[model samples]
Target: MKILGLIVEYNPFHNGHLYHLEKSIKETNATHTIAIMSGNFLQRGEPALFDKYTRAYAAVKNGVDLVIELPTMFACQSAEIFSHGAIATLNSLNCVDSICFGSEEGDVNILKTISEILVDEPNEFKIYLKKYLDDGMLFPTARSLALFDYINKYNLLDISKEKLLDILNSSNNILGLEYIKSILKLKSNIKPYTITRVQSQYNSETIESNICSATAIRKQLKDFTNIDSISSVVPCNTFNTLKDKINNNFDPMFDDNYFEILSSIIVRDINILNTYFEVNEGIENKIYQSIFTSSSLDDLKESIKSKRYTMTKVKRTLNNILLGITKYDMNNIKNIDSIPYIRILAFNDKGREIIKNIKNNSDVNIINKFSNISFSKDDKIFKTLIDYDIKASNIYNLIYYKNNRNLLKGPMDFYISPKYVK
Candidate 1:
């Protein structure tokens, strides 16, 4: 009954991921492992290297017992919301015992302390936070400085501002803190665990042996004159999956002209740009003007970015617009605790057992077939979230068509059934 939960992207399963999985299992001494993973889009506001199903299957086959999906709307979001969505989904399951994540700051106590501070949001902390924010510092920078000052002022736990800044600088540690914060905010029973990331730096763009970052792996794939080159990093099944994909002309999908597609949609009404998530503060005009000269995604991002707007924000905003997820929609739906249903992506025997346990205990519907869904079109809240996922799937197919040389057999989401591995 000790079911360990994990939140992951697993963009394409690799040795680093495998090691984390093993370590989590060993540390927890858990009988089952469940992962809630991102769909086609990732938290970084980019498409995954492979589709969700492929990555999920890769996870279940390797070490994870089961894999569910974090829907597209939350998948392409800021770190905090992304963590919130995932943790909420796990909470809904009512069976996960503990959650484990990779972190540069491997101490769960340290991350948990940071999470508690964030959740409490002391008045002094708020004062410094607003002070830095009003001074025009980015939210992350402001929050980091505020927390550092607040902690140092109290002289709590002998933690220095320099050490706290070092913790904030590492992306994995930041994400780990968010996960802990979400658990505390929800007051959930799930315990948090951290596995120290071994060799790969968070979001590093270089590949070194098997333990390179996913960012590095994607970068390697981009420079992959030979598709087989990645075999050293990913497992045999993953290597073969990637091999067939590449050989059949669907290899390098992450690189494409999403800018034109996004622009074509954005140009329809510049004023409507503010409607999408992250398209705030009168940034619509900048986007509309940028679309005309921007020949690529990078070009458009560079054009739209300002001191206030990071490239990740620009990319995510454009992605939200293209996918038809609006700021209005998110604002209305952000408080939802129960995501209407759970979509199972892949499972093994151990995973199947957990599914049975979930069905008997949780109220959330479990969907294995798209046709079996039972929501009314009039339910704008449910429709907006679910439709975004479906649309994102279809749009990824379009991206595939643009990236690949030949015709696709079909989009995996459309044709592939939920994978059940014995």
Candidate 2:
């Protein structure tokens, strides 16, 4: 069985995602597919429009065979950390044959060439990178400029500096590069492929066609756009699910909902902020000061973001603070392979078959029921990772209370189970 793996954040699986899934399976000639998706919080440091299980169910219904979650600790971080965790999760499965991703630059060779340079960090590349960082440029920008300079100085490839910078700048291409970098770092055998994104751009906020970006879908939903407006963009199942949710008065949520709690946490203890991941270089002071003037999440982000700190970086830092994800916690899982267990979210018959194959190849615990974690390899670090996911789920579930005052109380993860799709 050739199992194809995909790393995704199917916030609400749309037509573009469906096309990628179908096209990837055909291109790889795979018999089964596994998708490593983000939990409630996404890489951009925002809560998902819907819960993890809802998104995973849509993916399985649309075509994916299995959907396992990328743990919360790794899910809501920078591109490197996010890709490292996802690639490592797929590697741990021990049954996946190839991993495919959608990218603006669909050439795997080009992406791999850049990944090699990043992973190796040649002497000259290091010199250039250090120079840019010393000049006070943000890391991503500095790295991009450094790569451009190093490649041109050495004549590594026939590509122009402009073209190379373009590759590094495109969001999807940047992620694709990280995916290949992680693969090389681990020396994993899973082959990587790229499917060129078509139609809408990655962060486009307007629907150009039936395959608009998820950002556009979320934007419309945030404005309370009729579900019919997004009908043509998402799958039938997704549309129905979203429609039912809207009809029941459960609106799509965003980071704004947690603003008050986040502000309270920031003002409650300024000293504790430095302990969280990415809350360094005096950013905690800026965050603490911003809360006094900021009225919303976006306001606080704008107040803190600067040339050295990009908007995405600021957002991720705020989320880390709110979730109480500390630098110490991240240090323990520096080696991606240490991501203990596979947390299954949704699956089908083919997915079950893949699980059976996985059990034959690796000793990693496969958990579908939250309580099963107690019986699995018990350790402080392992329990800490699971606790973060549970905390995130409980917080995410809080939004539903606004619509249904009678919803279940307490943590949601304990009562939830992996969705089984026939």
- Per-prediction CA RMSD (Å): 2.4, 2.0
The local distance difference test score of model 1 is: 0.82
Q: How many steric clashes between backbone atoms does each model show?
A: 0, 0
Model 1 alpha-carbon miss at residue 119, Å: 0.7
User: Which number leads on TM-score?
Assistant: 2
Clashing pairs in 1: none
Best by lDDT: 2
lDDT of 1 by residue, 133-207 (tens): 999998978998998887778776477777888988788887898889889888899999998999878778977
Find the number of clashing residue pairs for candidate 1.
0
